[model samples]
Target: MTSLSTVLKESWGLVEDRQDRVAQHFYARLFLSDPQLRDLFPVQMDVQRGRLLGAIVSAVQNFDSPEDIDGYLRSLGRDHRKFHVTPEHYSQVKVALIDAIRAHAGERWNAVYEQAWNDVYDHIAAQMIAGAAEDTEPPYRHAEVIHHERRGADIAVFTCRPLQPLKFRAGQYVSLECHYQPRLWRTYSIANAPREDGTLEFHVRAAGGGWVSSALVRRLKAGDMLRIAAPMGSMTLDPQSRRDIVFVTGGTGLAPVKALLDELTRYNRTRFIHLFRGERQDDDFYDRRHLDEIAESCPWLTIVRAVSDEQGYPGERGAIPDVVSRHGPWRDHDFYVAGSGAMVNATLRRLTEMRIPSTRIKYDAFTDA
Candidate 1:
């Protein structure tokens, strides 16, 4: 078997020559050969194709050290598991990829190139299979949308069903695909616990000019079909731990934190939970009543609502981290922060400055862009 490093080094020139063509052909062959897989991809093949090729190029170019290369491969394995991509699908991809490379490389390509790619495919497929087995709750699209509600300017809540029963750790997100208009895809964290009932829910906030989000908020209605990728992300509650947990969220970031809170109660681990949520105003908050109810029922749970626009309500004001630092004990508890990239970064920076270890901080930064 050829070593991945050796193969990659030898095929550098060929990969460069055929990268774009290979990506185009890969999608063409995938859709042509397997229509079902086609539905799993974005409607705009050109955009997704560029992204796929760019990812591959970046991986290869960044293969400067063994550790970096191994980490990249591992991440690919993990992502493949999220999509439930099988070894057979990888095999199909390999066949099409090789053909694409050969077609683009022309006479310069030889038996060595074929051997190199074969080794690469085998390595990636083996890792993917192993990873899929290790993931106890692999991500998958649950079901189509049955109902939806527009609660705020850009916020919409959706009720859906999964194709299979989804058993997810709280705070995880599912990727959604919209068929109409811009026809792009994005991921939103689950806002509800894994109920005995067959329904799942998501709260989405439309960022202006956001392709899928704008469509879902303004145009999508009941009974419309949409595609959901499997649940993915590492944000969740730790059941085995006995320490108090603090959940801090901003804007639509409350979705995953809400799911985590629900799961904690469901498991009956009544650890102290301090939820500090920051939004523009009272009306900007989604599902505030439900959160209040959780706070009321669970003596260990405390809900703190913070508004940046301090007009009518006199509560904790300013940024979430500032509010948390002033009101809460920063040294003694586990923390989970979720929200936009700016919020996540701000919180992380403040926590670090407060001498909080990196291990205690877990966050789901909404990076849909």
Candidate 2:
């Protein structure tokens, strides 16, 4: 008998390249079946469209690793509470997803494949439902932008005060919705540890064709109201581990890493922390002064800044992975990495080559999609 993973992979391969078409078909069928569900998503559906495909692909790729993928799916499910998703919504999604895949697979689609998908999706939905039911926190919270500062041409630093205390670890991220963008939501890491005043900080860099990111960077300002969902992520520091730490980050990925470092400063006495921040150019290093101050006070902290694509640079130069590899023999240190998918993957690859155990490396790929 053919295994479910083999059948799912075979069927998915047929339609993976046509993801956009499949997504369009799925959403059309979904809304047609239940128009009320349309209001759950943003008016601009470009980014939202691809998310469905991405989720399915992730599940398919990790089908064999039930233990590992279950945690991620549950996390995804818990996070979906922000969208007001309920058990009924899962049924709708399952039907729409199966329909989309079947349509895209065409001649290759079979009852066997359909059943396999049903079983897998049912499991996914159940895990998600269980995750949602287990959480007692509110789906989302209202916040007021207390401060906003433009860092560069396309980046901004902002702070928001939640109407209620928004509890979260230093390295977690929360989905945010702005008044200007309505239902459109974007995920941003909190840039500080939990504070007495319940204020949260964020660093945003506008990307081309990014609706929410562009709005946050270019239009958001003080007094603006925003909605923030509960935090989600596991790249936080391990309190039990006494291992020294190395944080590798680039761009606005510095947010969560900075937060982790801030928390570390409060009680960290023995762990020597090395922070390697990379930017395309020197001017792009927006939070230099703040990081420098943190390093000054925290004698255990060392900050290294590297620049790529610039000439006559006074400091470290080259890609982040290359510069980071030079400072190691970091096999003994726990690694926390964040940045673009490319940067994260490259760093992971380099660390693996250095014989760093996979168990000691934690990374979060910062994507607004």
Candidate 3:
């Protein structure tokens, strides 16, 4: 019997040999056959090809151990959710990939090569389908930037067009693509829920090192055309469920949670919402007044602001997990943690220790750093 390890190793070697060629063929076929997918790709084919090939290489190499395979596949499934990749797309890519492999391997390629590649593609496609089933199409008809308010320092609030039409459930995010840098993109959650018109909004903090973000801060203006990917995330209000919702965030991570709160208020669902927001200081915080207004309007919504660098705040004074342990109702509430990787990982660990099931926790790490 050919073990998974053996097959995976051979697959990796085969892929490494022809990864670039496979990527080229894949893009050529996709663009030639499906103009829509071609439009989805950045104009710079080489850069996009490199990214796709690198991702495939990483995916195959990570499967060297069976233990690493499942997690790696699942992560791809989740990532593909945002891409809106379907079974058809997977099939197209698979055919192109296998053909490229055969071309590169020539006489050396045999039944073993066919079987291994088939197995890998099948596993990836199934997981992607599973992820797609859980996501819903975005409700907003059109998105446009109407108002841009500069908050203290690097923070700003962009009130968008379509006004307040449909409510964006808290914890859901919208992918933003800039015209100048089409390949560079970022996702920001709505800071407020639907009000009257169909307008959506976002709270963005300028990351100096981020190409797209810095461009948004410096060059983007009202009436600028911005492409937005559909909203897809697991973190949102569960109306039928009555579990407490703990929202822990840092920086602009507050956007999605605020959207969630808007939905909760609209439906008059009174689930306890604990919002733990961390920033460098009070000045670094955005939407304090709006959050306070929401707290005032909804008695069940408890907003806790944590300034990590400031000493004077009476509420939880340090990291989110510390505040969570001190004042959280973890036993009864589902948790939605967002922000930097370190903060999310720390909060996840604390939640696990607090005996909250992993299934009850949802998170979106905005930045890998």
What are the runs in model 1 whose C-alpha is more than 4 Å off? Answer: 1-41, 45-50, 53-126, 129-142, 181-183, 267-270, 310-313
Report the number of clashing residue pairs per model: 9, 0, 13
- In candidate 3, where is summed lDDT lowest over 10 consecutive residues? 134-143
- Please identify which of the two predictions, 1 or 2, would achieve the higher TM-score against the true structure: 2
When sorted by lDDT, best at the front, the candidate numbers are 2, 1, 3
> What lDDT score is found at residue 178 in candidate 3?
70
Compute each candidate's TM-score over C-alphas.
0.72, 0.97, 0.71
User: What's model 2's TM-score?
Assistant: 0.97
User: Highest lDDT: which candidate?
Assistant: 2
Q: What is the lDDT of residue 133 in candidate 2?
A: 89
Question: lDDT score, residue 244, model 3?
Answer: 70
Model 1, position 241: C-alpha lDDT score = 66
User: What's the lDDT for candidate 3?
Assistant: 0.69
| TM-score, cand. 3 | 0.71
Which portions of model 3 show Cα errors greater than 4 Å? 1-40, 43-114, 122-142, 162-168, 311-315
lDDT of 2 by residue, 229-261 (tens): 989999898989999999999999999998998
